[model samples]
Target chain A: MQGSQFRLEHGKKVRLANMDPNETGSLHDREEAEPNIERLKERLEALQNMLYAEKKQSVLFVIQGMDCSGKDGVVKRALGGLHPQGFQVHSFRTPTEEEEAHDFLWRAHRIVPAKGMIGAFIRSYYEDVLITRTHKWISEAEVKKRLKHINRFEKLLESSGVKIVKIFLHISKDFQLAKLRNRLTDETKRWKFDKNDLVERESWSAYEEAYEDVFKQCSTESAPWYVVPANHRWYRDLAVLQIAVDALESMRLAYPASDPELDQLLEQLQE
Target chain B: MQGSQFRLEHGKKVRLANMDPNETGSLHDREEAEPNIERLKERLEALQNMLYAEKKQSVLFVIQGMDCSGKDGVVKRALGGLHPQGFQVHSFRTPTEEEEAHDFLWRAHRIVPAKGMIGAFIRSYYEDVLITRTHKWISEAEVKKRLKHINRFEKLLESSGVKIVKIFLHISKDFQLAKLRNRLTDETKRWKFDKNDLVERESWSAYEEAYEDVFKQCSTESAPWYVVPANHRWYRDLAVLQIAVDALESMRLAYPASDPELDQLLEQLQE
Candidate 1:
């Protein structure tokens, strides 16, 4: 029941090899968690409605994972039942020509959800650290510099009433290989399979080590990264939904107080 | 019933003096227009829901007007009924130090409504053409240069699946003076009064001329400017609501087609 146990503590060294991606705390089977997930979805929708009415703060869910780690699936299944008007999903891909002209954070900063809104970033600014470091595109010194910039950016956003929830979908290498095979064999999902994924798979341990560094460096008290056990899709969805609902509930959101003058104005309009 | 007359044709010369701010076109009384406004609001909400579900084109309402010409009121009364989750209001005041460092359109470009969202800018980038030119802050050549930039910026947004609706809330000089007087006398509204408003009042004719040039130079077939008569608040709201509903309806938005595998997935979840 304590979701915070999954949060990577700030300043602590992370060993991804030691963490179990298949662990489902306190749940023996998917059947036991199914009804609870349904209940959490309803709670999320209600909380999202109040957040929109309150119009004071926003929540940002940053979902990052390797290929076939179910980042997109989690968003579609765990969060899809909420009102589309309040919830927006932004998938960050290769930077465009115009986007490259600015600093790395510029594009991400511009689209952070405004007050009374919920936004999810499927593979977010973290890519600059993960892919670039994994490919040796940036020096270790440069990676360190970018990590500081990211921390500062998150602090800036938090100061402006945005609650940042960083979730890393943790999947075993075998799970990813299986998912990739399914994508290749399934007609409906073949479009999702990319040959480049194989190239990245060769550096799986490097990516995991890089993510461990991200956990150790970027996790903060205000915006901590949660490592969700994502080998099981049902457990992944349920755990992520629970974490999201808990984050918003911690904000203590409520509708703005009604003005007495508006009541008088309503009477005039009716008359 | 015809709203097309309010749309300024691209490349046409606009004379603000010739356009009547008091005209309600074919409607003689507020009672006659009240029902139509209600109907349009309902239509707008329905269309907006589908637009959000479709997640394709975005809408930007650029509202510009003289002081006390009901820009804020129009957004509240005309658009207030729409879901706050999908509707966002951004009031552009003086540029910040960081904003001033970039091109004039940089801040605005960063915040244009994303797909399936509606964004309203109370005073938009057009302020560069209107206020700066009226006060002689920039040279005539510079004004011409910025106008060209504004047009290109808007064209960029339009090409990216954004439907831009430029509205000028047209109010007469006498109406403005009366509103200023009321702001001074009304205790609840006194906070809204600015001494600079009176100083800007001296340049009313200059602002009109500047806005006329903006209409002539920046208006395009894709995103035309509409001058809404604003002496009558009810009529102004009705006209704006009608124009917005028509603009969205023209987009012909629909929910994204359901996936064929969704039914099977739903059954799996239920089991």
Candidate 2:
């Protein structure tokens, strides 16, 4: 339940999120953590080629985090070099009137990648279960049903050979409050600081509790959740990259074998 | 009206589409005809930096083309470098029940780029005029009204500083027929050779006429239409890239200067 227990055993030091709502983690460590830039960049380039050629084993990355917890920055940095053709990032917002009418998972279902693709879901279906629970938008029984639906939905995705790597960008309430205040003062970001975000901020403890219960109910071995410390941007970015790279490596994808024509194409490009 | 007249006096190429839809230009002559791969790569990296910094200009690119004319491939190739955070690609399909109820431009409008981003529309509002005209899904009068609305829509976008680039991937019907046959014969491609496409191929001349009328009606100086020669994939890719690069370059975006401390942060990355 504590931060210490959340440590990942992958030689890569990946960590799942803490299940305990009260456990405090030292997000400061991310400030001092250095990125293996050269190594990581080379690996990403290789992954892009492998991804393009293998064209199987779709990846769905779910990024869940507190507001201003560096989720967007981490996502942008982590997948920077991947080919757009082989990958997509779907950012989920408040469901439209149309989407709200369907099952909460309907919109999220359509964005899952086809075979041989990598998809990142920002503020994903979990929002339905988490935010709806926090706001008491649905009954407790309905919330439990949705959570069960989520688990089954993920199980279906895993059965279809889609690898799901979920990460919760963990930050302290103090840091979030500071960010909200900064948004109010910053000219460029002021427009983005919605009144609802402040209202959502006020229910921080409630949201956290909702998240904890959802994690316990839905985090299975098939689709694990990684909790990345987000107070320090550097560490959070590195942690995300490490987790994603680890997941892809586990897939054991390789560059498609070069045909004679493939060699000819490379030669022509060189020419 | 001939291919010989498809030359640019200034940087702006004359809209030869209206004169002779058949006289497709040679892709080899386009500015990006032979994409200097190395330079393209450097340009893409710089583009990413600008996109992150500006985060201000959301661009929407609309691509319209005939069947087997390579809209999908061109989209996949041209946007290969752009970060998804700063760009999104939405391919419009046949209108659903809700989409059918709105104005022809409504669904397309709903998906336009937010300020300071890029959206690529594969088939867009123009469909109301083009496909509806070709298929007779609506009366000719409705098509005309939709065309006028689209012109106004693009004009409004331009006035609001959205660089509207409309591309029609011009291909000979003979080429399409040949590709169709190849698709029918090849197992890998046979899946893509839909019966609907076969029926549409029978009405090739009708579709061409519809496209010609569309060009005549909506081709304005503010949102001009370019007809790219798409018989050759390399040529089509280069032409599309030329249009995209031209649009982005004209924006004259500067790297958002973050606080001086940003440089210090980069210094830490180096260390």
Q: What is the TM-score of each candidate's chain B when compared with the real chain B?
A: 0.96, 0.81
Query: lDDT tens digits, residues A91-173, model 2?
Result: 78879999989988899898898887888888999998888889899989998899889989998998887988888888887
lDDT of each: 0.85, 0.68
Q: Residue B20 CA error for candidate 2 (Å)?
A: 10
In candidate 2 the C-alpha lDDT for residue B86 amounts to 67
For A44-148, candidate 1 gives per-residue lDDT tens digits of: 887887787777899999999889889877887788666554666788999999999999999999899999889989899999999999999999999999999
Model 2 lDDT, residue A259, Cα: 41
Error of 2 at A14 (Å): 9.7
Predictions' DockQ, in order? 0.04, 0.12
- Residue ranges of candidate 1 with Cα displaced over 4 Å: A265-271, B1-271
Q: Which candidate is the best by lDDT?
A: 1
lDDT of 2: 0.68
Candidate 2 regions exceeding 4 Å error are: A1-59, A64-88, A91-118, A123-163, A167-217, A226-271, B1-38, B41-45, B48-52, B256-271
Best by DockQ: 2
